[model samples]
Target: MELYVRLNDSTDKDYAFQLPENATVNSHIKAIFSTSAARIKQRVALSDLMVIRPSIFHEYEPVEYYKSTHPGHLTEGGCLIFDYKADRKEYLEKLDYEKPLIDQLWPGQLIVPQWRMSKKYVAIYVAIMAAWLYTDLPDCISPTPGICITNQLSRMLIPILEKWGVQADLVNKLREEITPNYNSVAAQWAFFGLHVLKVLFTTFFFYIAMANPFSFNPIKMYKIRNVAITQKNEKIQALLKYLGWIGARRATYDDYQTNYYDYIIKKFGGVVQAYRAGAIKRAAAPGVPLGAGEGFQTPLEERFTGNTFKRIDEENPKFILSEEYFCELENNLKELLDEADGNIGRMNAEIRRFRRYGIYEPSEKLKHVVDVRKEIYIKDKEIAEAGKTADKKRD
Candidate 1:
């Protein structure tokens, strides 16, 4: 088979090869470097060689890894490129990149909610609320509908009681007696049930897909593929785009420093490639690689997460803390203080009234006033801390 190779170092140059029909990509790579050493010189390391078949679409072709194990993947008269790599050994032992990094899952099944604040969930909640409101059918303001429902039920039962030769007046009196006793109780339960239903709806709205809940591979095979703790990839976004949320879903963490090696291998092509070019380090400390260097570890977190923790706030410190945020905090603090003062005033007046009647053993209302004061104190301290933090930012 005749093949043309373009060197990474010399992109303008082309090298031709007449290799055996049974030749694999790994064998061809070695043959290129071995035979072309005279012409190519010591341009790249023996440990650093990769053969890539360029895609016409300007995207990476999955055919590179395939060419090694599947001979037909690189056919006769193929145009290929040679690039510097961190590993040759792994190239000979290729991974199957063709098996997708993720699988498609529908929302037919559900798992616990992991992500939140989506408008989709909000809309679903609204619809559920509407249905609940219609079915539960309030008769009064935030009503139990208990008395009204029981009255309508009793009206039908009263006629039956008349047929059974029960006194109508006695029956009406009995109905009136029980309804008064249980009316408030029924209202409280209705309110309680509303709260319970709200929690259930929230839980349901937040549920994730049942299988591969976090965008994991459906077939968990470790036989051929290497173990990896990969970061969230773009495959989910791509899947969502193609499937339009209806077709695909994501059920989308960390281990020791050594745990990231295979992920790096999977990502950048190999271990040496990762250490030299990717985020992995043979470190003396966490991020500090041993050139006898000092400082924290090279950030594995930042490498995958792109420095998400420490966000860049490019606002003026004084304007944000001393003016804007301070105002908001002050308003909240003032509101709590005012509420506490009002409660104290009302409780003191009631105490005065009780004392006038000579019934002054200190009631639950007085105790409640003290609790409100304590709550106010806590809120004040919390608000003060926000102010203090704002001051630190300004300073």
Candidate 2:
């Protein structure tokens, strides 16, 4: 089973497998170290440490039996937790299995504008239409003037709609609905003419409102197209400073992406100690007697060296199994996963979910992850191939 492992202070997310029944801890560790020597070396001093665990059914037993000798074997992170609970067979097989908190949560994106359209902007649009309706005069009864006003308002609205990147056909239908009056050819012409004028007026004012140092008279600026170099340079510098501040953060040694597996192992002790005492079995005489087993034969001659795995028991105080901490952590992770899943699902559902709705443009962070995975995949494939070649040579 694939388990997501996050290392401390590292952007590198990795997946580790839960050893199947056929696989022994010895075989798994050896395989992992052999294939990923550099990565394993960075995280663990494999020669010293041993990783250990008991059967799933016997998880509650105290004093974990190690498969190898070691002080501790490094995990993906400084601390390790299973991210996907449903994938856990023991938990999933139960009829009462509640989905992990992580499964229900969503992760949000780092985006400049969280909203596609602002509420304030929408309110302004509505207010403008409402205010116009309220100002309709009592004496102006003719359909011609009404149609002219409606068409003019529509012409103004349509262009603004286009500028804000909305569908124009909808705006046109809205325009027709708002007018709801038809008259003579003269009225239609008046309406058309007035709409053209309103469109020009709205466009002009809109530009004025948005533009800095508004060029109310663009005709004059159009004639003098040659802009000053110093002015341009100043603008460029301002832009650079703006962007730099936005991107800048104080860097620290701790902030550097780390292999957490390496960090945990290093911090705990040397690799040999972790593995040898923690996991590995040294050959011992089967007849050797311990005080407790004086009357009976020892179940196994070899003892586990490393004590990596722990069982939840009464003496342990059940702190790790506490609902509050586990639930919180599980929920947080689930939220992140769910958010990613939701975004991808939404994008697929609505072809235009992201800017301009084109397929294959993922976030830069996602692209970085993809690149890292490719590198890891290539490295792993090479290691496997080399192992095969070495076995052949020995044969």
Candidate 3:
């Protein structure tokens, strides 16, 4: 049986091939790729390709000959259309081409626009809020224990806010509002002012953080740790470990050992003393000792010491593209250019033929042809430019 295959939507021409009567659709698709022109075959893989039967008005249905119970289901003059899946890297390259002028000219590292807040930032915010809520404030304004708490909290929050692109003016305002005052009247006002600022900042951060801008997997940290353990790259492992530690520290630290420890001791004596008193009370009771088997555990011992893998010097790392990848990109660009050129040539011939026969008029069909030709011309230029870029990269 003979089958007509259309690459892309070029229905004007078809590549015809003969196959056995019992051949499946999957086998037919593989044959189409294998037997088609080198340009088409090189750019597409069998796994990345899909076959569809085209119908009138641009509708299509999957030709599932592989699942068919009956043999010889494919009829004569039957047509199958092929299309390539969008390449993510190619999309990013195109994005680089179409970036805004301001973004292109911006100094320092370019941060791609994120429409939502990152989960990491949200986690950090929640941790900060938790620390604030659990820690107690002093009753008297003269001693200014509340002032110390506010200052310590502000110091911690400012860095996080700046990291997430909070406006400088707002950060400055936060610092100003939270700054401690010596006078009693002013100190009281400052206390209330700090509360208002915290509420405002928390609400604002929450709003922005609600939108997840990056493709961050929730389990990425665990994945990284697993990779670090298994992979031989020491530098990468170290980097991953460092990042994991930073995240852990941010989430776990509650100023207990540093800023808040003194306050806690002043209020409730030493933590050890409190723990001992609780233990004594629990000993007297028959119930499952209050909060038993809960609290901090000792740090786990490390297995590896020095770096095992070479650290990648990212400052001037060389990038080497695989020959197959380079060839695929080149062929894909050439195929696109050829398609556009063929389309333009065919449209030009049609227009000339109509004009020679005196059939050309200001009809919608002619106008459509002219518009299509213009579009083809633009596409041809873009494809040619892309092909040149690909060639340069290959070299």
Clashes of each: 7, 47, 3
lDDT of 1 by residue, 237-304 (tens): 33222212221111100121233344346667876776778346422111111110001112222333
Distance from true position, residue 301, model 2, in Å? Answer: 40
TM-score of each: 0.19, 0.18, 0.19
lDDT of 3 by residue, 192-266 (tens): 567667766865653533322222355743444454333576544443332121111110012212322343344
Question: Which window of ten consecutive residues has the lowest lDDT sum in model 3?
Answer: 71-80
Question: How far off is model 1, as Cα RMSD?
Answer: 31.8
Q: List the residue pairs that clash in candidate 1.
A: 213-251, 214-251, 214-252, 215-251, 286-297, 287-297, 287-298
Query: RMSD of each candidate?
Result: 31.8, 26.9, 34.7
Which regions of candidate 3 deviate over 4 angstroms?
A: 1-183, 210-395
Quick one: how many clashes does candidate 2 have?
A: 47
Give the runs in model 1 whose Cα sits over 4 Å from its true position.
1-122, 133-190, 193-197, 200-253, 256-395
